[model samples]
Target chain A: MVLDLLASGLIYSSIIVLGSIGLSLVYSIANFANFAHGDTMTVGAYAALVTFGAVGGLGGTVLGLPYGFFVALGVGIGMAALVAVVTEKFIYEGMDVGSIGLLITSIGIAFIYRAIIQMGFGADFTRYDIPAMRPIDALVTYGIRVTLQDVAIVASATVLVVGLHLLLQYTDLGRKMRAMADNPDLARVSGIRTDRVKLWTWIIGAGLAGAGGVFLGLFSRLTPRMGFDLLLIIFAAVILGGIGSVYGAMLGGVLIGMTTQLTPILSELGAVLPLVPDTWGIPIGIEYANAIAFVIMVAVLLVRPSGIAGEVV
Target chain B: MSLRAIVDDPNAYWSGLTRAEQGVSGFIAGFVVLLLGGLFTGILAPTYFLFLVGIAGMYSLLSLGLNVQWGYTGLINFSVAAFFGIGAYGTALASASSSPVAGNLAPAVGLFVALVLAAILALLIGIPTLRLRADYLAIASIGLAEVVRIVILNEDQLTNGSAGVRGIPTFFDGWPLLDTFPQTMPSVAVSWLPSGTVVLGQSFWSALLNVVVVVSFIAVSYFVLKRAHRSPWGRVLRTIRSDEDLARALGKNTYRYKMQAFVLGSLIMALAGVFYAHLNLFVSPGDLSPITTFYVWVAVMLGGSGSNRGALFGGFVIVAIREGTRFLNAFEFIPFDVAPLRLLLIGVIIVLLMRFRPEGVLPPQRELIWPSVVDDAPEQPDSGVRDSKAGESND
Candidate 1:
């Protein structure tokens, strides 16, 4: 039972990390919380769905995975990036507004994005065309069920995280991005092209968000509100990791994922445990899963508004 | 002429006006609301539309509540729906007798309890959150709202779960007229009000009572908030909003002040919820979604965030748009679902307003000029005006 929870928690952590990194990045560079970030995930998922529909015949299994899946992933990433850039240019860039204005604008954009998705998707649950992968019984020997999809998700997420770390540490563009995030005016004074870095920030951040969306769709059903539903969790992760810290976001996501998953288990245990009262055994139930994120966020804000790994306010 | 002048320069126009001029403007605004209500009841002839207006009035109350926080105090409260739900469920649980979990109290007592509960909830939420940045408060409040909603949804024994609590007693249930009017009144007397009036017999008095309750609430809240806005406490709130550090440096217990504002606003929101529950004659988890919070935010923004009158106007505008779309949905010629489109339009409107006219229809008035001061000094160099302008430019 512990293993099962851990396995699911790890999957959830990866998806959350991908989603939150973008949020942190944007928050760092743009100096505003992009409430519409989660919707970008929804857009990515829908993009994948559309791509899969268009390339049904090209989806034959390769290495126990479909080729169409890769195409859909690519398309999803591309579309999310496109949408982010377009919104930044048209909606965000033109306004010389304060953080509050930007924040309100993001809320507006969030509404618009959800409405558009509903308009296109008809507010129904959708699934990708790929056949469901069979769980590998060999991996279940340890009392935890594992599937090929889970393996793929974990492996790809690791690869992506490592790649991101390398890019940030070793690359010139990454250095510029870091500089810009540290201080945009200083970065500009130092001859770094801030606008180019900003554009790249949107591309990469939005791309990762798109990838997270695809993973979310794999783990659960696609709905118009999938991203909206996940928004608070993403915010929790971002804030918990300390805003603008990529590595912190990863750690925050893992912590949040594990806590949310394990809380129900613990609640169940309370019911059966000899020392606990019978009435106390009643599990808090899964409906409170989202509430866990909120509680954590509030607790964190109260205790440490700067977040665990965040710089001093 | 006064309308055009007010429209052209909302702040300066109001500030420059005489006491009589300002009263005229106030009267005109009041007249407009009454006129709209008259149009809904007298001409539209649909009892349903009147209900919509009443609902709009409820939203106006919500906007006013929000204005106290987001507008006057500059606290970004995203838990409007949460407090609203609390009021509703609190009243539902208190007044209900059918539900096993209900307190089975009178509706009036329920309303008082709900208000207290909402105020307490706000105090609890505010104590920890109000000390943080505006964004943190926003996040926390949204979280709190969701938590409340989840609890309401899952606790079937307590809140009837997702099925919702029904058969909630109306506010006018105990009225003597309800007992005597329907049985004693002739059919011709009932029909005398109007053809399509839903307020017939007992319902007529009930509807009248509801209007009286709602309108009185609006009037009382308006006067109270206006008084608060002009008082020293309101000045402190404004100071806290503009710059908390400065307020703190000036020896104000900014935290306590913010908490007070938060609790007061939440209490007002709960009051609206109580009215909403009685009006709808039911309470459900679905009625208290985050979307309703956004609707109020939109209203607050559209009406002018810092202005009480603007909040009221914004509420009416939002309700008109929402209900207007519902009315439009009946038309067979229009293609596609109008519901989503209405939301889309609202979203667009918010974005556009933020971009172009963040100040809203009536830009918030800086200060109520005393007649003596106005005559003595036609143009007082008010620092508040300068600060407000700075705030406006940033948006």
Candidate 2:
């Protein structure tokens, strides 16, 4: 049972990390939390779902692999990239003239983005069928009975995280981005081609957000409002871990994932208690179980403001 | 860099405000915002006047409370809704338990008790949460707000949770009547304009009565806070807003000052809740959502930070726009089926306004009246300068 929960928890962590890395990146470089990051994820997920429905599932496999997943990933990435550009130009660029100013502007722009999504796409939930996500459960017993899509989420998350780590730490572009993040003025003074780095930062950041959105869609289902809900959780993770630290965000995500996933399952034990679950729901209230992890974020921030890893000055 | 270059830029937007025409335009625009509000009420239902004006008044009270924290103290309070809700509940229960006749433990006493309790609650929450810098405080306060709402909702005994409280007394007694004549439908008001129509199961006159009470409360609050915001105490607050460290260095106990501002602001908000309870005559957990907090923020931002009148003005305008647009379904262009579009429109308008115009339509300038300035005496160096005149005191 422990292994089962952990396995499922790992899948959620992957999704969390994917969405949160962009947030972490934006905070590290942009110096303000992008409250709207989750909305972009929503925007990307919808864009891909709408696009996939238009195409004939990207046709057959290339070299015997399903091309449909890539089609989804490509569409997700493409949409994320487009969204990042538009938001940066219209929303973040002008208002975020100062770092902290960006924070407030992002909140407003988030409302706008959410509004547009609310207006155009409407406020209903949706889902798309991923054909390749089947038959994985047969391979493993005591696997806590996760779905095929759950396994895909885990695999995709691992690839994305590892890929992002490599891309951020080892690549030349990554170094330039980091340099710019460290001191935007100095980066520009040093002729590091800061604009190129910023553009890519948003591209990668939003792409990850998109990937997170896709995984989230897989994890549960799609709704116009899925991003706004997820945004708060993801923000808690980034802030709880440390601003701008990818590894911290991943760790934070896993931790939050476990807390939310495992806590309620443990709440059944509250039922087992002599008088607790039936009378009080004590130790944990299962009805508002969703509010549990966010409370933890607040508690963590109150106790430790710089987060788990202190933010760089 | 020289302080001269930093402090007074010849071509600064603020400098342009020192020009007489701009100042006249500012006052005109301010009046225009109010006129627009009256126009909004006229176009919709006149009964909507109560809702619009009441909401603006309500938002003003909340923003006033926020301004005390953010505008004066440079504190980031993301949980304005929670405090406002507290005020609402606090007042509702107080009024529910009030008796009109007894001078001591009577209706006025109930109000006093609610106001005091609300202040205490603000301190209780603010002490723990406000210790952090702006970002963490923002997060923690937001968290605290959520926690409180969830708890109130969960505690169905004290609060009705999502169902909310009802039948709280308006407490409009004891104050002398402003409209000395017996109330009646106006002799010449537009027809089909809800001027004398039944609304929300309430007679237009009764709703108008509620609006009058709420507006009066707001007006009184505006005067009191406006005075306090300009006083020596208010000066210290402005100092804290501009530079907490500087304020602390200058023999000011910043923490106590912060606590005082927070509590006072919260008290005003609690009163707003009291107003809200009477206005809606019904309260629900729905009214205490995070959205409410942001709406207040939008009001303060849209009006002008630091200026109590501006914040109050913002409160009314934002609420009117929101409520008015939602009520626009009365016209054929919008069917009732698409009324869900209200949230989307509000979100878009707020975003566009904030993004394109962060200073808001009526950005806070100096208190135009000398009396408004006299009490607020620390003498802000060129209040018209840009870059957060309220939040960044460097002296």
Candidate 3:
């Protein structure tokens, strides 16, 4: 049972990690919490759904997912990036009310994105056109039930994260982005065009979020509110790992995802493990999982305003 | 100008007003006339109109509550809906006949319990988020609000789950005279109406009573805010909003002040919720959605943050947007649902408002210093910078 939870946790964590990195990057570089980030994920999911519908599964399949699905994923990422950049250019570029203003504006943007998507898609849950796959027979014996689709999701997320890491560390644009995120003024003084880098940040950040959205759809189902629903959990992950630190976001996402998936077994853990009191356990049900994450977030804010990886203030 | 001057020489006051003020006054006057005409012509029912007024008043109460926190102290609270829901559920669970937990309580008792719960919830949320950066509060409050919604949604034993609590009596259920006033009122028919006789019945009287209840709530809140906004306490909050470091340097406990404003504002929001429960006569988890929070936010911003008058105007604007979209449903040419259209309008309005007029339509124009203190110190030079920062975003 625990192994099954672990398997599910891994799949959930990959999606969360993909989301957190983008949110953290935007928070650091854009100098405001983008409330629209979640809705951008929705845009990606819906965009991919449309793409997958348009392009039927090309003959061969990889890890239970059709090749066309990967093509759809790429389009989703691109579309999300394009939409975000366009929004930034048209709406956000002219605003001068500081970061706080931007934050409020992002809420408006979030609603707009969701409303448009809802208008088109209708307020209903939907799934990709892919056929459902059962848990692998081999893994079911070990109590580790997961499908090839889950493996594919995790693998794709790893690849994306690695690619981002390489882009941040090895590339010149990455260095510029890092420098800009650290200090916009210093980056500008050092001859980097802050505007261009900001545009790039939106693209990369929104692109990753888009990928996360697609994976999230595959893992569960898609609704207009799906991304908005997942937003707070992603926030917990980012805050836990320390806001603005990409690596920290990854760490936080994994921990939060594991803890969330493991919540159903919390009462059993006390009885299963050797403890002073056999019955001593948190009696909370799985419904309180999100609430638990939020409580942990508030607790983190109380004890350490600066997250685990952030510089102590 | 003094109230006495306006009362003594109303014509002079009217003539002395700027073109913009005159235009706004004229618009309001015209709109009221149109509304009354609609009521008399049978185009709009009096009961529905009264209900709209009650809802407008509720939004005004919410905006006023928010004005205390975001307007005066610059606290970014995104959990307005949570506090509002707490008030609604708190009262509903206590007073609703169908309540599985607690039933058959007087609404006054429910109001008291709701306020206390709201205050406690405010402190719990405020204690942690208040000490952080401004935006952090926005994030944390919203996240915590989701927790509140989830709890309300999942805790079926307590909140009656998603089905919601029904059979809530009106606020005057136990009150003497007022309790039976709506029931005792005779139906009235206006014979002079062009569209024939318009009847006002028990429901109309009930709605009128609700409007009266909400008006009292608004009036009491307005009076208290007017006094508080001009007091030394309000000055300190304004200072904190503009420059917290400066307020701290002057030996003010910024956190305490923020928490006080947060709790007070949350209490007002809860008050709105309490009113909503009795008015709507049902409470559901859906009432706790974040959209309600944002709607109040749009009201505050559009009406002019920190200005009570602005809050009132913003409240009316909200009703217009909300009801106007519903009216859009009457037109069959529109293919999409009005719900998404309303969302789109709200989003567009927020974005545009921030982009073009971040100070809002009716930003607080007066200096925030206590009238008594400033009146006695007339020799002090008015700093333009400080005045400009009155209701605009300081950050």
Query: Any runs in candidate 2 off by more than 4 Å, and if so which?
Result: A1-5, A56-69, A95-97, A129-143, A183-191, A265-282, A287-290, A311-313, B1-45, B93-117, B167-202, B331-357, B367-395
CA RMSD per model (angstroms)? 6.4, 8.7, 5.3
TM-score, model 3 to reference: 0.94
lDDT against the true structure, per candidate, is: 0.82, 0.71, 0.91
Descending-DockQ candidate ranking? 3, 1, 2
What CAPRI class is candidate 1?
Answer: medium
Separate clash counts for every candidate:
1, 10, 0
Tens-digit lDDT track for model 1 on B269-377? 9888998888888888998899899999999988787889888987887877787688787799875656677678778988998998786666575454443564466
For candidate 2, the docking band is acceptable
Error (Å) of candidate 1 at residue B61 is 0.1
Best by TM-score: 3
A-chain TM-score per prediction?
Answer: 0.93, 0.86, 0.98
| Segments of candidate 1 deviating more than 4 angstroms | A57-59, A62-64, A269-283, B1-44, B176-205, B371-395
lDDT of 1: 0.82
- Deviating ranges (above 4 Å) for candidate 3: A276-278, B1-23, B369-395
- Give lDDT tens digits, candidate 2, residues A133-245: 44345645765666656766777778888988898799999888878877889998998987778888888989989988877886778887788778777877887788767
The lowest-lDDT stretch of 10 consecutive residues in candidate 1 chain B is B186-195
How close is chain A of candidate 1 to the true chain A, as a TM-score?
0.93
Residue pairs whose backbone atoms clash in candidate 3: none
